[model samples]
Target: MSMTVARRPHRLLTMAPAVLALGALFVIPAAPAVQKGDDFLTPETTGVLNLEPGECFTDPEYSPAAGEDIVLYTTCDQHADNQSYGFVHADDGPYDRVALADFGWTSCKRGFVNYWPGAAGAELDYYPILPTAETWADGDRDIMCVVYDPRGELGGSMLPRAS
Candidate 1:
């Protein structure tokens, strides 16, 4: 007498999809989401340096078209009289959805990072940052200006501080 055992290889394959979906579901909860919207600045709104309480503009540092990149000079100060702290500068991109922290002349931990604005219909995306480091400590600044490169392409949309 002889006996045979049948193995279901397709069962393993079918399980693969489920495992991947399950993993993605868990990852979705911890990620930041970005949204797309209109610009808060009008062409008539001049004097970005003398902006009002809820005003902002994009100061172009670098710009690339088609096959070029643009870096921008940005300054954000919640306090409108002196542009002392809470300032960020990104000299490396016309990139989409990249945020860089300006650490000044030192090799501070800075780099492009992604952020998601919440409240409804959230999304998952990424951006750029400069000098990325984990052990960075705040050196005395209440407001920090991050060079925002929104994949949503809403870079000049007057984003507020992350609360």
Candidate 2:
């Protein structure tokens, strides 16, 4: 006996709309959270000083005015890994790297993204950029810092008023 396979006919009426809908859903673009002079900052990125929900954040450097505390609005949380919890520099080139020195934590790590959480506002526990501490320490003092909280954004975004 020969096995006769029936071919399924193509149905555009039912399939086209479904395909289009799926495409549209997947193709929907989310607005970029971080931009120059923009309030939002990303946790994944370390160089940016501004914090934004759905974005990484950083604090500006305390230079020339070293030892002089920079007013920082940071997220609050205690992570198991010290590296994960504390602030970090974004990149090299002048703002080579650094984190706050005298450290403290607030109650909140997860802040409002579009919600723009209130900064715990602490004196940055800062340190200088050195090659030795790479493995142990985060990095050089960057004008950039981040607000890390796993609850919502994992990191906090800068408030509009912070700008």
Candidate 1 wrong stretches, greater than 4 Å: 1-3, 9-11, 23-163
Q: Write the per-residue lDDT of candidate 1 for residues 54-134, one digit (tens) a residue.
A: 343343223334233222223433222111123344354333222332233121112212223441233222211222222
lDDT per model, in order? 0.31, 0.31
RMSD values for the candidates in order, in angstroms, are: 15.7, 15.4
| Deviating ranges (above 4 Å) for candidate 2 | 1-6, 10-18, 36-74, 77-163
Q: Write the per-residue lDDT of candidate 2 for residues 13-108, one digit (tens) a residue.
A: 669988998899888575533222212322222333333322322334454545532323334331110012233333333321223221111112
- TM-score to native of every candidate shown: 0.19, 0.20
Candidate 2 global TM-score: 0.20
RMSD of candidate 1 to true structure, Å: 15.7
Worst 10 residues of 2 by lDDT: 77-86
